[model samples]
Target: MSDGHPFRGNWVARMYERVRKCGYDSLTAFAEARPTASLEELADELGPDDIAAVQVFSGLVAEAERSGKVTRLVRGQLVRELAENLPDGWPAVLDDEVRFAVAEALGFWSAYTPETHKERVKQARAALRATPPPPGWRPLGPDDELLLTLLPDEEV
Candidate 1:
């Protein structure tokens, strides 16, 4: 998987294609269509690679949010799905880069205001911290600087 990316494999690619083939133009659309679908159901449909599905979903969500294709409501739904579905010891399956990407996306989406956004960031960090990487795996910390840079002075 691209030397080190845990999510850049045939399975994840196939999952993306399957989402496209399901009459959805993008992953965001697929997520929007099944707002109530559990993550377990999605993972089951994608194959046995639930970890890869999570990674791919996170990446897709990040891309959609960055592109302005995902609205606040949809973003919230996706984030909630992530929080609810990820399995125990899930962090062990992810590499530092993937973790950083996820943190970046969460941080970006969580930026709402000085007060509320700060609380969101705190919660995101706590969640990430709770899942430590596997033994000997060097975990990357969240990119707070990037989040700060992306967040505007005034809330949008």
Candidate 2:
């Protein structure tokens, strides 16, 4: 059925605009409220001329979830493996300062137990000072922010 309004393009543009003005979840819920229809159906009824935006948004959500899960799994595995490989009495063997540095380098401690990890890091650092890790280690820094800023935004 023709949308009574004279507008000719797909109405998903309006949805996208709404998302830009409000938020993605809000627009998604708003779109979903017209439950009897699929995204294409809703687009046709609302006057959106194309489904590109909907397709893009859907793809983005799927990709992000997939990527997040994969990265989480890999990082978790690495953390477990590293923790297992450390010499017995890891904290005691490494100096406090060196332990902290190692923990920071590992990057797995950002979750709920961060402070505990940091404390362990300090202990490890103290022990490690006596026998430093081979020279290539250095603190990660601010340039990474540029990479983060360059990532694309999701749109639908």
Candidate 3:
């Protein structure tokens, strides 16, 4: 897995080309089709040899920013991170052990967040922890009700 997508030649162009070949007009479309797939899985689907997860995310972020849908992307990222780190979904309990797992997932989401949205993501994280969504609140996609409620689209 190339950390920064060391692939030569316009990597973003290549990424979009692969996405189009997969019958999707954008990376978001391809990713939305399999919302829970990890970044690594998305990259592997695009091009295992040259594409990387970070590249998949980079392209997605660029598209999202241009479309003024960064909030949606942030929520989608949380879903992906949770899916990968908490495969069984949010636990029904909030015990110390479970707390760590939850923190780990959120931490990764924060780490992957775009710089401009870092502060907003931090606030969202706090709200999620404070409210503590129901026992098993596993969001299948970015449009999940709670996510929208917590972090409404500031762009619009």
Candidate 4:
């Protein structure tokens, strides 16, 4: 990924391009389709950079879901694909936003233990507290909402 922006760069850009080329009109459309075979095919093509794009895309989808831009069904399906299909440590490589998103998704889907989900959410909050959001960033998205639910009232 590029240092200039969280969403730009070769792999992230290509991921979007591939989505369109794969016959999906948008990420939401792809999520709705839940084309497992196509997703697996894309996963096979992923290098390190492409994996990073998946992480970022995961975060973006989470934010959209929280904002009601994405429906619950679509969000669940997309996150499930990401969590199940990606390599191990994929969440670890991401920033707080992506980590928090993945945690929320996993918890919602019951894909991991309650304890494990709590730990992941805790780690994500700590990371958020340590690093401020980038310029032009907004607050109260999915990450903030999840953190509020996980953290003590005073902390929120």
Candidate 5:
């Protein structure tokens, strides 16, 4: 059996490949449609431990995105603060209450003004156009709720 990380390197590699093949914009769009969808639920359905790890990972990603650490925003402050605040990273960043607070803050970010959202949409479309979709895979289906729920806003 594998050790430590539940997801094998191959699994993560496949996920990244699938994501790149599908295009991040399309993947993002597909993930954003279902607002009420629960990522935790989907993850739980897969396995409780898996969901927990994913939650921790997502929390880290969301926090990084918010502070502009991941998205090329302000670098030094967020990095230092986040590191100081959560040495163990997101899971230990804060207690349950603080975690919810962080999640709420991240949620607010998803609701950019119409103009900004439009700009984002335009950028996403442009990116998708630059990278063609892979063979065999069709566009996200209407019933792809699981994927939709995993967005920064949703889930997936």
Candidate 6:
């Protein structure tokens, strides 16, 4: 890690140690605390030089899987993506800029989505594009009213 790269050593232990250092017992709790923060933002907060965004996400996914809360994680990820890509929230109209921003957000969200929820996340993403949310709509958290309506909790 002396070379200034974030990926090095036992990534699992490294990430979790950083997460604990931030006063968070679980990665999801830390992530959900700042629902709108991008993965890069979270990683940077943990350790810009030793923690990468992917490590944060990997820890999040593993925790979510173990806790049967992957859907919540997926939605939370969407919140992060939206905040990063749509600083102005949903556009007033679906112009070129809006489409590109939305695409970037959705693309990154989809990438983070787990295989178990890929199809459902895809459907949710399609629904959003087919019928965009209101202008200036920015979800503050994963439990946002509109988000829950689009992709409700399904784990039993």
Better of 1 and 2 by TM-score: 1
Prediction RMSDs, each to the true structure: 12.5, 18.3, 2.8, 14.1, 16.8, 1.5
Give each model's whole-structure lDDT: 0.47, 0.37, 0.88, 0.43, 0.34, 0.88
lDDT of 1 by residue, 92-131 (tens): 4557765665565455445421343455456545655665
Which is superior by lDDT, 2 or 4?
A: 4
Ranking by TM-score: 6, 3, 1, 4, 5, 2
**Residue lDDT tens for model 2, 6-99:** 2345444554564555444544344434432333444454344443334433432344355443222222222332333342313444567646
Model 5 error, position 129 (Å): 45
Clashing pairs in 4: none
lDDT (0-100) at residue 16 of candidate 2? Answer: 57
Q: TM-score of each candidate?
A: 0.40, 0.23, 0.90, 0.34, 0.25, 0.94
lDDT of 3 by residue, 1-156 (tens): 234444777788888888999999989999999999999999999888889899899988999999999989998999999988778877888788888989999999999999989998999899987778876778999989988997788885
Top-TM-score candidate index: 6
Q: Ten-residue segment with the worst summed lDDT in candidate 4?
A: 135-144
Rank candidates by lDDT, best first: 6, 3, 1, 4, 2, 5
Better of 1 and 6 by lDDT: 6
Task: Give me the runs in candidate 3 sitting further than 4 Å from their true place.
Answer: 1-6
TM-score for candidate 4, residues paired by index: 0.34
lDDT of 6 by residue, 38-147 (tens): 99999989888888898889889889889988888899999999999998889988888778989999999999998999999899988997888999999999999999
Residue 50, candidate 6: C-alpha displacement in angstroms: 1.3
Q: Residue 48 in candidate 6 has what lDDT?
A: 83
Candidate 5 lDDT over residue span 1-156, tens digit each: 223343744434433344355454322332334222234432343344422325323543554455443331111112223333333433423468755643443333332212324444344334433542232222232233321222123221
lDDT of 6 at 22: 81
- The all-Cα superposition gives candidate 4 an RMSD in Å to the true structure of 14.1
